[model samples]
Every structure is written in C-alpha cells, then in structure tokens.
Target: MTTYTAINLIARPTGGPIGPDLFEVVQKELPSVGEGQFLVKQNHMSLDPAMFGWMSPDTESYIPPVELGDVMRSSGIGEVVDSKHPDFQVGDRVMGMMGWTEYRLTNGVGLNKVTAPLPDEAILSVFALPGLTATQGLYSIGKPKKGETLVVSGAAGSVGSIVGQLAKADGLTVIGVVGSDEKADWIINELGFDGAVNYKSENLAEQLAELTPRGIDVYFENTGGPIQHHVFERMNAHGRIAVCGLIADYPKQTPDLAPNWIPIIKKRLTIQGFTMPDHFGEIPALLEKLTPYVMQGKIKHRAHVLNGLESAMTGLNLFFTGQNKGKLIVKI
Candidate 1:
C-alpha cells in the first residue's frame, strides 16, 4: 500500500469532555524502511487513562505532552511486514509504543518481539502495560503480605483488576471498588475477589467498612475520588498505598478535593505514585514473573475492543464515564 491512515492530536483539551474535533485522521504516503529499520502493520492499539495527561499542556508530568500534529501517542501490537534489520524478521509479532497509526516504521529500538500462545486481546490486556503496572505497583510499592487486607479503587479496570487478582493469589484478602453492581459481581464472582463495593452505592463507606473489617493493610489507589477517601480512613497502621493513576481527576480543570490526611499520619501510610515510563527497564523481569500466572489462569483479563483507529477518540472517554468494563483496545 502506498498510503496509510493515522490519528493526530490537533489541539489541547481544556479540562472538558474530549471530542473527535481535537484529533484529525489523515492519510500519508508510506515511508521506506531504513537499513536498520522494519515496517509493521499495527493490528491493535491500546487506549488508556494516561492519554488524557499526554493530551494536556502539562509538560511537567512524568512524560512530555503529545505535540500538536503528531500521531496520537499509544502502545500497539503488530506484525512486521517488511524488514531491513537483522534483529527482526518479516512476520515477527511485536509490541511497542507505535502510536495511532495503521503502519509503523521502526529501527527496533523499543520494540519487544512477542510469541503469544494466548489471544491478542489477552496479550494486550494482561501482558502489556496494565499487567506490568499492576505487578510493579502491588509487589514493589504496596509490599503486600500474606493475610493482609487489600483494597483497590477502579478495581474493574485493566490495572486494578490485575492488582486484585495478583493480591488474591498471594493470600491477601481482596476487596474491589467499582462503579456499578455488575462490575462488582464480575470482580467478586468471576475474578474470585473476596468482596466488591459499588462506589456509586449510597452506603459506600458502610459497605467498605463491612468488607474490610480487619482494616486495609494495602490500598491500590487507581481512581482518586470519594472511594479513596473511604478506603484511606480504614487503613491499618503502617499500611502501604500504591498510587497508580487518578482517573477521576484527569479530565477536570480543578483538582479534586484532597482526602483526609489525618489517617495518613495516624496510620503511618507509605504512599508512592508511579508511572510506567520510569519502570520500562523492569518490563522484561515483570513479564517473566507475570507470564506464568497468565498461562496458569491465575491472572484473568477482559478487553473492550473497538473496531477502528478512529474509535480511540471516543474510546478514551469511556475511561472517565466508567463505561468500559475492562481493558480498552482499538482493533485496526
């Protein structure tokens, strides 16, 4: 093919709802692969909460903002259709930060070749950023212990779901806080979580208290909202918190109100915020650790797959609306 399609960030969002107008889908002539580069036909692209942070004018973040007119930054899995590099062969399946393009030309720098015995959706859901983030934050930051009570906010999401499952595997009591009863049921009944709290329920605090009677020893904070406040107040002394993502505050112009800090002091909480970029080097080790769980079905995942690259603009809104039940992916 002479040309391929790509989505480009055209403007910065103003803390309001995102729309297709901020992005432009354009067709461009395919570029030739350099002597050390290869061409990939991107099959699937991931839509994540971090995209909102990348779309904003916040260069002070862990990574730079997506520059205007650039292909909207994303991670994708694809097949190498053409190659001039010895490290990668034609027909090799790989994953990397390939952005929102139908085809990617790369020098094999950041790419990791994947041989998946599982479906593409599962690989993208559990073996990609979501799984790595969950593994790192929970084991590295949360420092989970056997029989400790653990609570996860945004518990139905890609990262949170994996966090709950991993914690459960380690013999910790797992409670997942989600937006709806259906999600609650999925986490508890399907994912084997000990308890699930619907954050939208009128008696959320009471429900959380009932589910975590032992007091939470590890809190995996994914969405910073009232659910976090409820969990924070119930933390045990010396409790650990892995602050992964604040999806609730991502699209807002003003920051959400801070949760009570008295508990942080009284409980001697250890809170740490992390981004996947800083931990990229650890992915190989993480994948080695996580792959066995996935193969054994000790870790499970779901994907809300959208049909085309253009769907990414709307798919991202699902993260904020709590509409997506699992990992969000755009199938190209």
Candidate 2:
C-alpha cells in the first residue's frame, strides 16, 4: 500500500461522550525509511484513562496535551517491517508511543524492541503502562505492609487489579471497590481479593465498613467517586493513600468537593498523587520489582479490545460508563 490511514485531534472534549466529531480521519502517503530509522506496522494500540488528560487543553498537566491536527498520542506493539537502523531489524517486535496510525516511520529513539514471547494483549495489559503504573503507585506511595487491610477503587480495572493482586501476594488483606457485581465477583473469586464492595449498590458506607472492619491501611485511588469519602472515613492512623486516576471526575465541568481535611491531621495520614511519565527513567527498576510477581502467577489481567483504529473514537466512552471490564485496547 502506498498510503496509510491516520486520525488527528480536531477538537477537545466538552464534558460529554467522545465521538468522531473530535477527530479527523485522513490518508497520508507512506514515508521513506531513512538511514538510522525504521518503519513499524502497528498492530495493536492501548486506550487509557490518561487519554482524557491528553485530549484536554490543560497546559500544566504531567504531559503535554495532544496538539490539534496532530496524530493522537498512544502506545502500541508493532513489527519492524523495514529498517535502515542497525539495532532494529526486520520482523523485530517493538512497543512505544507510535500515535494513531497504521504505520510509523522514525529513528529508534523512543521505541523499544519487544523480546518477551507474550501476546500483544498481555504485553499492553501488564508490562506496558498498566503494570508499571500499578507498581509505581502501590509501592512508592501506598507503602503497604503485610497483614494490613487495603482497599482499592476501580478494583477491576487494568491498573487497579494488578495493584490488588500484588498487595495480596505480599500478605495484605485486600478489598476491592467496583462498579458492578460481576466485577466484584471476578476480583474476589478469580483474582483472590479478600472482599469486594460494589459502589453502585445501596448503603455504600455500610458495605465498605463491613468489608474493612480493621480500617484501611492502604488505599489505591483509581476512580474517585462517592466511594472516596467512604474510604477516607475508614482510613487508619498513619494510613497511606496513593492517588492514581480520578476517572469519575474526568467528564464533568465541576467535580465533587473532597472530604474535610480535619481527619487528615487527626490520623496523620500520608496522601500522594503520581503520574508515570515523571518516573520513566526508573522503568528498569520498576520492571525488576514487578516481573517476579508475574512469573510466579500472581499478577492477573483482562483486556477489553476494540476492532479497527476508528473504534477508538467511541471506545473511550466505555471508561466513563464503567462498561469496560479490563484494559481497553484497539486491535488495529
């Protein structure tokens, strides 16, 4: 093929569902593979809650927003079909930020060759962004100790599920807060969580209280909705909270106010917010800490994949609706 398809950010989100109106599909002529560069045939790409921040106009975010008329930013696993670089060879599997396109041609600067004999879905769901984010937040911020009770919001999601499993393997009593009974069942029965509280059910406070009778020693915040207050109220003295993603507040022009801080002082809690980009330099160490858990059959994940690159236009709405079961990916 002489031409390839690409999607560009045409407009920013405005507090509603994501649709094709925000993007423009175009065909571009294939570029020449220059010296010291390679061409990748992107096969699958990741869809993440972080994309909402990337699509926003906010200038002071952890990473720069995607520029209008530019290919939307994303990471994917692809094959080096043609290469002029010595390090990367033809048929070498690679993963990196290749954007919203079927083909990417560039120097081997950000891209890393994939050597693990795992499927694309497993790679993206675990070793890529999801597992890395979970490890960073859970270890660096949560500071969980064995025998302590832990609670994680969005417990069925890609990152949260990994966090819960890792904490469980470390001997912590893990409770997951999910949006549905099915998700709750999966986390508890399949993923080996100690307990689960469906946030959509009535008497949320009571449910959380019963599940976490020992008080929450570690709280991994993924979706900050009404559950945040309940978990905060149950935080034990010197409890640690790791704030990852506030998915519930992403689509709203105004978010709900947080609980009073008087308890923060009374409990002497440690709360911190983190983004993965800042610690990209420490990936080798993070992976070193996470690989053992995976090799030991401790880390479990599920992928909710969408077909075709264009499906990404609407696939993101599943996150806000809480319909996606696990890591969202696009099978290009």
Candidate 3:
C-alpha cells in the first residue's frame, strides 16, 4: 500500500488569523486507482486569499466550505505517477483541484495537462488561475480601451500584477495601488506601470490624485477597504471596476459597512464582482490571449514559495500582511 501525507481541515476558522491548530497533517494510504482514475504526485500547491472564504462556514459563496476532517481544498500542479485513466498517461504533468496533499487520486474530470515550457511555479502563477482571472476581469468586466487610465489594487500580487501589465499592453495608462513603497517601485520601475500609490502612506488620496490626473477609467479592485473609497472618489464618469477580491475583510468576523454608492450612481459606473470558478470554461481562450504577453516578456510574474505542506497554514496570512511579493505557493 502506498502512503502519503495530507493536510486536513480539522476545524473551521472563527474570523481571525488562521493558525496551525485548525489543520492536521496525517499520513494516509492511497486507495487503488479505480477504472477511470489516475494517481498524481503533487509538486506545487497554491495558497491564495480565496482560501479564507472557503474556510468559513458560508455556503452561499461561489464554492462550498471545506468540511471538517476533509483534505483542505487547493489547486495544485503535479505529474501523473500511475494511471488507469484513458485521457491521462502515466508521465503527464497536470494541474487541477488536487488539494493540499503529496499525492492525489482523480478520475480526470477537471484536470488539465500542462504543456507550457515554463517551470512548475510559473505554470501555477501566470498560466494558472491568477493569469486567467486578470485576463477575464480586465477585458470582460473592465472593458479596457486604448489610452484609458487603469488602476489595480494589490498591484504587486499575482492577479493584480498581471492586470497592470495587460492593461499596459493594451496602451492604457497603468497605475498600481500597493501596500509599500517597495512594492510600488516594483510595479512602477520593473513592471512598467506609469505610477503607483502606497495605500499605507499618509498621502494616499493625494498620491492617487497626482498619479491619475485624468481620473481612473478602470479600477481592478482586489483589496476592498478604505483604499477603495479613495479610488471611488476619483473615478471618471462611466468608469468600470472589476471587483476581483477583498483581502482586507477576509480575516474579519464582520466586514466593514459597504462604501457609499452615491458615487457609483452619480458617476454612472459599472462595477462587477467576479470569481474565477464561474469562468473556468474561458481559460483556454484567456490563455491564448495571455500567452504572447508572458512569452514576449511583456507580462512578468513572481512566486513566493514555502518549503513544505505544513507551511500553507501560516503562509496564507501573507496575503493580508502584504508579506508575499507575488503568487504564494507551497512546494512539497
């Protein structure tokens, strides 16, 4: 019998920092691969801000919560080590919702074969969910036009960084809202963003006003908090906002009150909230649109990797703390 390690959600979080107590690492024996199933050795697992929402008891979310005693749900990239499935071969490298485990047995339902020439980390970073989210949200919801002013919150992050770069490729003036001056510099100097505002600065609103003299035409919203209000007040008439995430409120039991909608009405803005799960069918097409940018060095990416599966619990907090520079992943 083959044995492997897995991380299980032992308890649901009660609206605060997630600690090691909430999870248990256990060794479990793998069941024999059934008729259509294959076995994969998970190489890299992604830790994302969305995990907090999945840990909550909220069933109304885009996806269901991870039930107690179940393997914590996560997206991972792995190579097929054994297979009885027709669609998958033994040596195929695949990516899918394989959870936080060293090994996974799947029937090949949602699994995607990885064929990109990039590294496993890059596959999980730019070509995976983050890249797809940025592409879909920017084009489908934000409706970016040439020469428009586009600003993205969490701009140094996986999704936000891609959004900024993609907007730049489309000839839009890109501005990034980040947590620190260092991150601001990375986006402005390295990622080719025209300007950046550090939300932690005392002059946040003033900085945004200066960077975006034309007013914000498209806002790729990631962390919704006071920074959201500052951007809201500077939006151009008929501006578009793609609400990608709310990392600011993820740890709170009760989120802050909704921002005033008066500006939304007065500005005649178009604001749409999206989750990547609903757009999975569009990935191939989105990748087709994004591959050139990445291959051509126009879209840059980075991954902050933790060494083992156990680090995932503590690493998730990096999203809220702004400690992670880009995509956060756990390498097993």
Candidate 4:
C-alpha cells in the first residue's frame, strides 16, 4: 500500500473562507491502481477562483457543491509514478482534474498526457488550467483587431495577464484594470500593456474614456460586480464580453441590480459565461497556438506559488483580497 497526504474540505463555506478551517490536511493511505487507472504523485495544485464557488453551500450553480468531508476539488499536474493504464506509463507527465491529494487514482477520463516537458516547477505555469483559460476566453469571446481597445479586469492575474499580452500581440491597444498601483506598474511596464488602471486609484469610466476614447471592443471580464457595472456603461456597440469569474462577489451574496443591467442591453453586448473543462476539445488548439509564444516568452506567465497544502486557503485569500499578481498555485 502507498501512503500520502491529502487536503480535504471539512465543511461548506457560508461566506469568505479562512485558512486551515476551510480545509483539513490529513494523511491518507492510497490503494494501487485496480486495472485501467493510473496513479500520480502531485507536485502542483491550482488555486482557482472557481474553487470557492464549487465549495459554496448555495444551491445555484453549473457544478454540484462539494459534499461535506470530501477532498477539495481542484486541478493539478504531476508525474505518474506507477500505472496500470496502457495510455500512460511509469514516469509520464500529465495534467488533469486531480484534486489536492498527493497521490491520485482515476481511470484517466479527464487527464491529458502532457507531451511537452514542463519548466523547473514540474509544470509550466501557462500549460496548466489558467493557460488553457486565457486561450479559451480570448479567442472564444475576444476578437481583438489591429486597431481596437482591449481591457482585462483582474489584469495582473494569470488569465488576465495572458489576455493582455495576446491582445497586444494581435495589435490591439490594451488596457488593464488591476487592484493596486504596484500591480498596475508590473502589468503596464513589465508585461507591455499599453496602460493599466488601478480600480483602487480612480474612476474606471474616466480612465476608459481617456485611454479608449474610441470605445472598447473586447473585454475579458474576470472581476464582476460594481466594476463590471461601470464597464458596461463604457462598452462600445456590438462589443464582446467573456464573463470569466466574478472574484469581487465571491462567498458573498450579490443583490439584484437596481437599474436591472440596463447598460448591458443598451450597449448590445455579447456576454458568455465560460469554464475551461466545459470546452476540452479546444485544448489541442490552445496548446498548439500558445506553445510557440510561451517557448519564446512572447506570451509570458506568472504564478504565485505557496509552499505545501497548508496555505491553500491563504493563497486563495490573496486572490480574493487582490494581494496576488498572477496564477495562484500550491506546491505540494
């Protein structure tokens, strides 16, 4: 028998989650692969904004709430230590929906064998789910043109960072909406965004008016709530909106819009809600197109990695509180 550490969600969260309490780290025994399944030793576990929604006690959602006393749901990358599956082998690198467990067992329905080698961190930051997300959200919803304005909310975060770079490469004037000036400086100066507006700094509408006087054609919406409400008012006619995640309203109930989303209708926006797994067929395309840029560092990646499984909640809080710069990951 193989033994390992697994992080399990002990309870459903009513509101904002706190460290350790939201999850319980425990040592668990692992069984050998029965027949078709492969076993992996996890090295990197993703901390996604969607994880909070998945653990919500609320009944409304696309995914079922994490049942009480279950290993927390997450995506991870690891090396296969042992295998009974023919498709995988001993020491094959793979990416999949394996949760926080150090050792995973599954029939490999969702896992994809990562044909390419990852960086020193075991898996490339952009090669995992966040990388896939940027590709999906950008091309699927954002049709950025040579002379258009593209703005990414949560611009300093993983998906948003990728979104800006991809748009800039496509020849669009890019603006980023970030949480802090330090984040703003990094995204604008280091990452090559045309400009960035710190939501904490000034009026978004005013900034949009100054930077994108011609109006915004594409918006990669990662933060919803009041910011999105303001953005809708500044949106151009026939603009496309990729509704990614609403980190601002996470673990908190959103009240009904008093004016009833009037700006969305008036601007004739095309808003589509999305998740990466919902469209797995695009993975090959995403990897195919994104690989070249990543290899060359044309499309950059940033990840704030927390050591071990204990900081999962803390890392998530960094995201929720706007303290993080890019993709949040827990290195196990």
Candidate 5:
C-alpha cells in the first residue's frame, strides 16, 4: 500500500492574515488506481497569491475556497509513476490542478502530458498560469505601445516580473515599482525594465511623476492601496490599467479605497480587473505567441524553486515576505 503526506486545511481563516497553524500535514493511504485512472509522483506546486483567498470561507471569488478537512487545492507538475490508462504511461510528465501531496491518482481529464523533449520544468513555470496571467492581463487590458510608459506595481513577483519584460518587449518604457532594492535591480538590470522604483523607500508619487514625464500609458496593477491610488493621479490621457491581483488588500476584510473615479473620468483611462482563468479560452493563442520569445531566449524566466511539496506554504510565505527573487515554485 502506498501512502502520501499532504497538507490539509483544518479550518478556514475568518479574518486578518493567515498562518501556518490553519493547516496540518497528514498521512493518507492511496487507493489503487481504477481501470481508467493513472498515478503520478507530484512535483512543482504553484504557490500563488490567490492561495490567500482560498483560506477564506465561501467568499465570492474567482475560485471556491477549500472546505475544511479537504486536501489543499493546488496545481503541480507530476511524473507518471504508475498508470492504468492508455493516454498516460509510466515516465510521462504531466500538469494539472492537483493537490498538495507526494502522489496523486486521477482519471487524467484535467492532466496535460508535457513532452520532456522541450524542457524539464518548462511546464512547471513559463507554460503555466502565472505566465498566462501576466501576458493576458497586459495585452487584454493594457494595450501598450512603442515608447509609451508602463508602470507595474508588485513588480518583482511572479506575474509582475513577467509583465515588466513583456511590456518592455512591446516597446514600452517599463518602470517597475518593487518592494526591495534587490528586486528593483533584478527587474532593471536583468529583466531589462527601463527603471525601477523601490516603493519601500522612494517617494513613490514624486518618483513616478519624474520618471514618467509624459505620464503613464499603461498601469499593470498588482498592489492596491495608497500606491495604486497615487499611480492613478499620474496617468496619461487614455491610459489602460489592468487590475490583476491585489496583494495588500487581500489580507484585509475590505479594500483600501473605492474605485478611483477622478482620474478615470478626467484622463479617460480604462481600468479593468480580471483573472486569467476567465480568459482561458485564449490561452492557446497566447502560448503560441509567447513560445517564440521563450525559444529565442528573449522572454526567458527565473524560478525560485524549493524541493518538497510540503514547502509550498513556506514558499508562499517567502514570496509574501519578498524573500523570493522570482517566481516561487515548490517541487514535490
């Protein structure tokens, strides 16, 4: 009999910040695969900001919360260890919305077989939803142009980092607003953003104004609060703002401020909030375009992967604390 250790949500968080205590690691015996099911050794679980939302109970959300006593919902890379299905075979690598466990058995409906001939962890990161979220948010909401300025808050996180480079690739002068100097350096020096503003230290509004003299053409918003509100004040006429994820506001019971009507009406800007899941219909189209850049090493990636699936919660904690330099990934 095979058993696996998995993280389970013991209780839902009512309010305030979530803690590790809310979850428990439990050992569970795996049932033998049925006729059509396959089993895989899980690896590379995604630790996203949206996980925080999962902690809340039954909130109106993009995805439902994890019921108490349920295996924590997650997406991960898995290697087919055993199989009883024709579509999946032993030694195949796959990805899907799985659970936080060492091994998983499924009917292979949601699982997509990733060809190892391309790259080992390629499906784990770039070809995953994080990249999709970043790419889709910008192109769909932020119609950037050559020589225009694009401001990205939370600029060093998984989605934001990708947004910065892609915006730059679209010929926009990218200004990243990050939490740390190291994060700022990575975006500016490596990711090739035009400049970086360390929001933790800099005079944010003044810096944004000076940096974007002509005003910002697009704002890829990931943080909501005073900084985002301030960013609204310096928008170019007809600027586009894509509200993807709000890290600061998620932990709070309420939002920092109401929608900014002042700038939107005055600047004639378009502010749209979206989750990539809602835009999954266009993923194949987006991936097709992104592959060339990835292959050419133009739109490359950086992953801060931690071995062991149990570390997914830890990886997410590291991400929130700004310890993660790039996309935080957990390898089972």
Candidate 6:
C-alpha cells in the first residue's frame, strides 16, 4: 500500500494574499493502473494567474471553478510509471490537466504526449499554455503588422514575454509594461523589446509617450493597471487589443473603473477577450506559427521554480507581488 500527497481547494480567496487557509493537504492511497489506464508521476506543474479564476466560485468564468475538496485544477507534465493503455508506454512523457497531485490515474483522454527534446520547464514556459496563449491572442486578435508599435502589459511574464518576442520578430516596435526596473531591463535587453515601462515608476504617462511616439497600433494587455489607461489614451485608429489577464484588479474588493468607451469608438479599436480552453482545437496551428520563432531563437524564456508541492499554496502570491522573474512552475 503506497500513499501519495495531493492538495485540494477548501475555500475561495476572500481578499489579500493567497495562503494555506484555502487548501488542505492530504495523503491518498495510490491507485492501480487498470486496463486502458496509465498512472503518471507528475514531475512539474505550472502556476498561472488563471488558477486564481479557477479557484474562484465564479461559474461564469471561461472554465469551471475548482470545486471545493477537489484537487486544485492545474496543468502539469509527468512520466507514465505504470501503464495498461496500448497507446501509452511506461516511460512516455505526458502533460495536461493533472491537477495539484503527485500522481494521477487516467485513460489519456485530455493528456498529450510530450515528444520535444526540451526540458519540462522549457516545454511549460514556451510550448505549453504561455506560448499557446501568446500565439493565439497575438495572431488572431492583434493582427500585428511590421513597423507597427505594440505594447504588452506584464511583459516579463511567461505569456507577455512570448508575445513581445513574437511581435518583435515580426518587426513590430514592441514595448513591454512591467512592474520593476529589473523586469523592464530584461525585456528590453534580453527579450529584445524595443522599449519597456515600469508600471511602478513615476511619470508612467511620460515614459509611455516617449517610447510610443507613433501611438500604439497593437496592445497585448495582461495587467490592467494605470498603464492601461495610458495605453488606451494613445491607441491608433483601427488598433487591436487582446485582453488577456487583469492581475491588477484581481485582489481588489472593488476593481478600478475601466477606461471610457469613447476612446474605443473614437479609436475604432478591436477589443477582444479570450481564453485558451475555447481555442484548444487550434493548438496545432498556433504551435506551427510559434515554433519557428522558437527554433530561430526569436523566443527566449526563464522559469522561476519553487520546490515541493505544498509551496504552491503560497507560490501564487508571487504573481501579485511581481516577484517571479519568469514562468512560475512547481518542481514536484
């Protein structure tokens, strides 16, 4: 009789930072790998801002909330340790929504085999949700053109970094909105973004104005903070905006007032909000568009890894604090 540990959501976040109070850690007996099923030993799991919405009680969200007492919903990469499925082998590497657990027994319904030579961190950072989301939103919504100016909030994050790089590769003038001088410097210096605005710095409007003198042609919004209004003010006519995450308002009891629609009408902006689950069918095409950038060295990534499974209980706070330097992953 072997036991494995798993974390379950017990309560929704009320306010403030996420802590252990919302979760319960329990040990469970490992299940046998029945016929047509395979047992996975999860090696690494992604920690995303999306998880916050998943844990919320909002049934209207793009995906269902993580039910109370259920293993917290998350995507992870693992190796098949025991298998009875004909399609899966014992040493096969697979990734999907395996949740916050050390092990999972599944019939390979949603799981996809990982055949890339990259490590788990790189795979998750670029090829998984971050890369997929970036490609989907940038190509489908942004409609970016060469020489156009593009601004991406949360530019140093997994999705934002990829978005900026892809736009830069396409000859767009990429400007990233980050939270710190270090992140701003990394995006500009390392990721090759044309410019970066530290949202925490003074004179945000002036900095953005100086950088995007031509006006923003494409906006990849990840954090809806003061920077949003500034960017909204400068959008070019017929501009496109891809509304991704709004980490800025996630913690507030009452979110800040959004920018007026007068600008949207005046600018004739194409503002669209999207979630990856809706476009899961288009993953192969998104990958086809993104892989060349990665293969050509146009895409670069970093992983901020936390050790152990329980670290996830508090690891989420890194998103709010802007402490995570890159993609957040739990090395289980």
Better by TM-score, candidate 2 or 1: 2
Assess every candidate by TM-score.
Answer: 0.98, 0.99, 0.98, 0.93, 0.94, 0.99
Query: What is the C-alpha lDDT profile of model 6 across 1-332, one tens digit per residue?
Result: 99999999999998789999999999999999889999999999999999989988899988889899999999999999999999999999999999999999999988999999999999999999999999999999999999999999999999999999999999999999999999988998999998889999899999999999999999999989898999999999999999999998898888899999998888899999999999999988988999998999999999999999999999999999999999999999
Query: Stretches of candidate 2 above 4 Å error?
Result: none
Instruction: For candidate 5, write residues 205-246 as lDDT tens digits.
Output: 788788888888899988776778667888889999999877
Compose the digit string of candidate 4's lDDT tens values, residues 1-332: 65788888887666765577778888888877778988888888888888888888767787787877888888888889888988899888888888878888888888888777556243546777777898898888887779988888999988899889888888999999888999889988888999888887667777768888887899899887566766676779889889898887775765435224666678787888898768788788888887887777777667788898777866778877888767788888
Q: What digit string (tens of lDDT, one per residue) describes model 3 on residues 105-212? A: 999878899988779999989988899999999999999999899999999999999999999999999999899989989999899999988888887888888988
lDDT (Cα atoms) of all candidates against the true structure? 0.91, 0.95, 0.91, 0.81, 0.80, 0.95
Model 6 steric clash pairs: none
Q: Any residue pairs clashing in model 3, and if so which?
A: none
Pairwise lDDT winner, candidates 2 and 5: 2
Clashing pairs in 4: none
Runs with alpha carbons beyond 4 Å of true place in candidate 1:
none
* Backbone clashes in model 5, listed as residue pairs: none
- 244-286 per-residue lDDT for model 1 (tens digits): 9898998888988977777788878899999999999999899
Candidate 4 segments exceeding 4 Å error: 120-124, 255-260
Which candidate, 1 or 2, would have the higher lDDT against the true structure? 2
Of candidates 6 and 5, the better by TM-score: 6
TM-score of 3: 0.98
- Candidate 2 residue lDDT tens string, 1-332: 59999999999999989999999999999998989999999999999999999999999999999999999999999999999999999999999899999999989877888888999999999999999999999999999899999999989999999999999999999999999999999999999999999988999999888888899999999999999999999999999999999999999999989879999999999999999999999898999999999999999899999999999999999999999999999999
